[model samples]
Target: MKLLTVLFIGLIMMGPSDPTFKVGEVAPDIALPNMNGEIVKLSSLRGQMVFIDFWASWCKPCRKENPQIVADYMKYKDEEFENGTGFTVYSISLDKKKEAWQKAISKDSLIWTTNVSDLMGWKNEAALRYKIGSLPMSYLIDGDGVIVAVNPRGDKLEKALKKNRKSESWFKSLFGY
Candidate 1:
C-alpha cells in the first residue's frame, strides 16, 4: 500500500510538467529593451492584436523570414479585414551583439514594427519563459491577451489576415449593409 501510494504521487507530479503555451492561454507579458535603449512591455499593448516573433541573427531561416513578416505587417497595418481585427508584429531578437541586432533590423527594413532584444543570446528571459528551444518561433495573441496561434509561418500569417478581414466585413454587413 505504501509503495502504491508513492508511485501514484510520483505519477501525478510527472503529469504535464512541461508547460507549453497553447491556444486559449493568456500570453505571458514580457518587458525588454529595444535597440535605442527604450523599454517595451507586452502588456502595454492591450487591445491590439500582437505577433511576438523570436529569432536570432545566426539563424538562416529567421533571416529569410524577416522580410516576409515585414511585408505582412505593411499589408495589414490599420486595415480592418472582414473580421474587424488588426495586427502588430513585435519582434524580439536573441542576438548576442547589440550592433548585429540593430544592423539586421535596419537591413531588413523592419523599421515600422517594435523591435527589442536583451542581447543575452539564447539566455534571453523571454525565450526561457516561452520555452523556446529553437529559432523563428512566433506567437499570435488576440486583443484580449489570449494566444490564438503559435509558430505560424508567413503563408499562414497572410491567410489569417485575410480571414480576419472577411469576418470583419461580414460583421459590418450584418448590422447595416
Candidate 2:
C-alpha cells in the first residue's frame, strides 16, 4: 500500500503536461484583435494553407524576414496548395504597444488581412497558448488545419511551399479528375 501511495504522489508531482508545438499536431486556433480592432481567428482560414508567424515589432530578425514573407505571399497566394487553391499568412504579433505593431505591419508591407495581436508583448496570451519561446517562429498549416512544418524560412520556406503543391488535376483525381 505504501509503494502504491508513493507512486501516486510522484505522478501528481509531475503536473499536467502542457501542449507544445509540433509538426503533426493541430495548430491551436488564435482569436485576437487586428490593427483595426477586429477579431481574427486562425481557423477561419481553414480552406487554405496558412503560415502562422509569431513575431514582434522589436525583433530585428522578424522585421528582416517580413520582405521575404511578402514575396512568398505574392508568389503563392494564388497557387494551388495540397488542400486549397491558394495560401495565406496569419501573423500573430507579440507587441505590447498597438502603435508599434501597426507601424511595423505598415512598414513591412505585410499586406495580409489576418494580422492579429493581444498587445501583451512577450506575455501575449496567444504566444503562451502556442508555447512560443523565441521570435521569428512559424508554423506551416495545411488546409485541414493540421501543421505540416515549422519555421520553414528563406529557401527552405520556398521549397516547402513548392513541395506541397497539388496540381488541380491531382485534387480532381480523388473526386474524378
Candidate 2 lDDT tens digits, 65-170:
8899999999999988877768999999988888899999999999999999989886888888877666677889889888887787667787778777886447
Per-residue lDDT over 1-177 for candidate 1, one digit per residue giving the tens place of the 0 to 100 score: 999977754543332334369878999999999877889998877666677888877666788888888899887777664323567888889899998888888888886547988999879989888876666788877777787767777698776566456565587678864
Which segments of model 2 are wrong by more than 4 Å?
1-19, 168-177
- Checking candidate 1 for backbone clashes, the offending pairs are 81-165, 82-165, 82-166, 82-167, 82-168, 82-169, 83-164, 83-167, 83-168, 84-168
Residue 136 lDDT, candidate 1, scale 0-100: 73
For model 2, what is the C-alpha lDDT against the true structure? 0.83
Best by lDDT: 2
Residue pairs with colliding backbones in model 2 are 172-177
Candidate 1 weakest lDDT stretch, 10 residues: 10-19
